[model samples]
Target chain A: MSHKIGFEGYKHENNVGFFGKENSKDGKDGKEGKDDICPVATQVHHLIELY
Target chain B: MILVLGQCSDQVIGAFMHHCVKHSVDFAFVDLNQLGKSIDMDELYWFFPGQSPVSHSDITGVYNRFLDWPKQNKYQMDRLLSLFDWLDHRYENVINRPKDTMSNLSKPYQLDIASQFFSWSIPKTNIIMNTQIKIKSPFICKSISSERSIVNQVYRQEEKAFYEPALLQAYIPGLNIRVHACDDVIVAVGIQSDAVDYRYSRFENDIFMYHLPGQVEKDILALNRTLGLRFSGVDLIYHNKKYYFLEANPSPGYAYFESQLSRPYISEALVSSLSRSIH
Candidate 1:
């Protein structure tokens, strides 16, 4: 399953809930969790338009 | 360091930030709503909840996707504007600088600019004020402001009321093509829809990655360069073996296409481009 977040449900006060997926599991430091390294990142085309 | 300025709910900015995190790249995001509260500007401080404060000098390149200023008290807004102005002068690799982005707010102005390019053409357009005006039928009406989408069939009536003149253009029936360009990198998609405005029927529309003719690609690049935009989403129509330019969007919303269509968009390209510029 591909995990995705949408603009409709995002809240500024709770950005960690959106970006801090790793921290959510372990209750680790948000900053450190944010910097967790994943060498193989998804790379796609530079443009994406629906219509 | 890369800085993203926009709404926290903005999925496009969120995705780009994710890419940066996965690659272990230095980046920071400032929600416009947190301007005077969480993000203070005595000298530049970023107070991400639970994270240590960061300074502005740490940032090098900024990906500015801030569409509108926050509706805060006048003093706070002025302070935020001053901070933005300072950043504008400090950073050299800011994508879609404020001035360049502001120029594209008007749809008519952008269409006029796109018309000047050789690879694109525009539909016969006019600002209709009176019902007495005569024009071909099946024309589409659009709002001059980008805030609204008023694409509707032209109906003949007496005493039409418009606070501002509405745009009327000869409706060209053809494939809708959207081209997104970031510097030399460009991606074009063809949209097939039954509705006049494909955006209204997004789920029903069919999307396919398009390969643009070399000349068309060059022309788009030229248009981007001419407008001094590092990234832009351009709308066009393919009719009668010709392309009709629509408008240029300085801050395009690509999250829908990225998630639904599974296309690698500005996410990876933006990181690499910003990283390259910094190095």
Candidate 2:
């Protein structure tokens, strides 16, 4: 009931899709959707490791 | 053939399909959400209007309207992007390959590059990972990767309300607005949201309007060029009469605004732009 359009809720409305955190199997202490806010960083690191 | 991703019946998807048909262009629809299993690449090589993926290799171009890719498997996302990359490289003659369309869809990357000019209003946002969600008493938190509507929450004066790691920002008291920034023209919708929540105002009765500032128009356009975003739906918040930059949607749902306003301004503009790009 208190749900709000995150974009409208916060100023970063476009970031709605990128905020989801899929934590690793480490559970609660594991990662959240770190890629949500900045997937570019992870993507870059992934790409470099690929090379 | 141009492939319009997503389901065919959806209004916006249908519009894109209809536009291709009206222009007598070759196109196919790839329902990634409907795609069943670990299929081979050949299954979706070519898209036939009024038809599903086929074994044919004559697929010349693609409109690249695949939004559901992110939701699909990494292979799914790569498969769709790969097709576009191939189409652009192999048959540039078949696909639009227009700069405007590309920029329009990459709103995030575009905004990243355009932030320099609009740094004042835009939030001091950082794309961080694993950094425990930091809050400043009454702060804002949202998942940047969310897809649903109104599922994002705003914490009010709570230190550890949800305890979930999310986007934390300094909550600003202002007007929330979405600006329809196509390649040529820019239009915006303003909402008077509760100084704190406002994001959830969709369910609550609130004041909203369509507005444009004389000064911001030029800068928005310039920022568009800087970001290489041909067409984008950007969120702009106005607090104390000064505008602030929120975010941008490269492939926004124009239908929502058009239906809510009972007008097809943005939708029609998008259709027209797509047609011109193909021609």
Stretches of candidate 1 above 4 Å error?
A1-51, B130-135, B152-161, B261-263
lDDT of 2 by residue, A16-36 (tens): 221112212222210221111
DockQ category of candidate 1:
incorrect
lDDT of model 1 at residue B172?
A: 87
| Clashing residue pairs for model 1 | A44-B264, A45-B264
Candidate 1 local lDDT, A9-30, one digit each (tens):
2334445542323223242322
Cα RMSD of predicted structure 2: 11.5
After superposition, which runs of candidate 2 have C-alpha atoms over 4 Å from their true positions? A1-51, B1-3, B8-11, B14-28, B33-63, B70-81, B86-112, B118-120, B124-137, B144-153, B161-165, B192-209, B277-279
Candidate 2 local lDDT, residue B143: 50
Q: Tell me the tens digit of each residue's lDDT in model 1 across B1-279.
A: 677777654556766666665667777677778777766655666556556666666666678876556679987776676766765576667876776776555667877888887876889887755445544366777876555463645543423444467777778889998887877888788889877776654245687888888999998888888888887777889999999998877776654344434546656667666656554
Question: Which candidate comes out best when scored by TM-score?
Answer: 1
Residue B151 lDDT (model 2)? 24
